[model samples]
Target: METKIFAKDQIDEAVALLREGELVAFPTETVYGLGAIATKEESVKNVYKAKGRPSDNPLIVTVSDEKMVERYAKSVPDRAKKLIKHFWPGPLTILLFVKEGSLPTAVTGGLKTVAFRCPDDKLTHDLIAKLGYPIVGPSANTSTKPSPTTAQHVYHDLRGKIAGIIDGGETRVGLESTIVDLSVETPIVLRPGEITPEEISEVLGEEVLINTGKVSDKEIPKAPGMKYRHYAPSAPVVVVDDVNDFAKIDFNDHIGVMALEDELDKIDLPKANKFNLGRNLVDADHNLFSGLRYFDDKKDITQIYVQGFNEGQASLAYMNRLNKAAGGHHF
Candidate 1:
């Protein structure tokens, strides 16, 4: 199949493709998402096939507004409403009870709950509004690969596999949305992103539990990244907790270092072998995946050493993705 690249304004072509049960990738603040109309079972299943994603790993439904969510969600709790007022059209995904038969099993992963988000991108919102229903959006890259923050990243990994890509340029957040499961009595964050649990707690005026335990292989993950390895490159990644640890490693041409600008200056590696992750945690969050992909393009990079931050000080979302990419390997 031919893979097309659409301009940000070219929503008609992408929407038409989706209407024909074809998959098209759309952008959000967090990441570019492979979109399939949520109600179309065949299209939704093809999304899993396209990404080689596990069938049981559910997808998040991308909607245009709260009304779209109300159409499918059994009931939106007051807490969810409060969160929506604060975080909707941003990087927050709310998991809610689904009305039976409202969405395809392929989308819900046969679970009674479904995740929904209204992206901040105007083009994406317009596309969804034009389509007249929600689209199941998982990160556009092939499963287990670094999530695509740019359209070129999507094209590199998924060209010819999906119908087309709506190029909305680079994503802002550079990570997935914070997923809060409101289906249960006590809201638990199934995944962390730009929106922290503390921020969510403050908005809802209640305690939000962060699920840190690994979901077993025998069990289906309630969220996309929970049960699988994700955001990894071809090279092995080592998390460097202390910048001073750079002195301990025997530097070689095959090693690539990703760290803050100042941290890179302290390292002895060649300038070509280092990728700057910028000044602070927010910059690191935005640059993380791009840095991983940068090294992937360098065939000689056998391993990657990335800067790590304390769980308390760093964005949990950034650390969560880095931990997965590194497979918990610390330097």
Candidate 2:
């Protein structure tokens, strides 16, 4: 299959491919998502085949608007309405009880609940609206790899397998949406992203639980990135908790270092060997996957050393992704 790259204005082209049950990658504020018509079992299955994603792991249903979610979900609760009002069209995913037979089993991973999100990107919103249905959108990269923040990154991991990619430029959030499971009695955060738990709690006017425990491999995860080793690259990654620890690393072998600009400057390494994580936490979140991909491209890089941040409301999302990518290997 010849994978074409569509410009941002080419929503019609991308919609046409999706209409034909062809898998197309679309941009979101969070990350690029590999899209398949949510109603079509075959098309959704093809997404798993293309990305080498496990069938047991569920896919997120990406919609154009809040109303689109009402079509597939059984019923929207009052709490969900609060969240949708504040966080819709942004990096927030909500898990609600699915309408029976409304979506394919492939989309829900045979579970009664389905994850839904209305991406903030105009091009993707237009694409979903034009199609008049939801699309099953997981991060547009091979399973367990860093999520694709750019169209070119999607092409690198899933070039010939998919039909085409809608190039909407680099994603703004550079991470997946914050997934909250509303199907339960009390809402729990299944995955952390740009949206913090505190922010969600503020909107809902109640405390939200963050599920920090690991999901065993034998059990199916309610959200993406819960059960799998996600956002990792080919090289071994070690997390450095403190900026001063950079001096402690043995630089004898070929190594790639990723940190904030100030942290990078503190280390004694060549510019060519260092990948900057930008100036602050937001910049670090935006540049995390790109930095991982940057080092993965260099043939000489054997191991990667990434700076870790103190866990807090602001830094939780970044640390979640970094710890997973590093596999908890600390310096």
Q: Best candidate, lDDT-wise?
A: 1
Off by over 4 Å in 1: 311-314
Which whole-number lDDT from 0 to 100 does residue 222 have in model 1?
Answer: 80
| TM-score between model 1 and native | 0.98
| Candidate 2 lDDT over residue span 270-317, tens digit each | 888999989898999999999988988887888999999985878888
Whole-model Cα lDDT per candidate? Answer: 0.92, 0.91
- Residue 138 in model 1: shift from native, Å? 0.2
Backbone clash count for every predicted candidate, in the order shown: 0, 0
- The per-residue C-alpha lDDT of model 1 at residue 163 equals 94
Residues 31-106, candidate 1, lDDT per residue (tens digit)? Answer: 9999999999999999999999989999999999999999999998899899999998899999999999999888
Instruction: Name the weakest run of 10 consecutive residues (lDDT summed) in model 1.
Output: 309-318
Candidate 1 has an lDDT of 0.92
| Candidate 2 Cα lDDT to native | 0.91
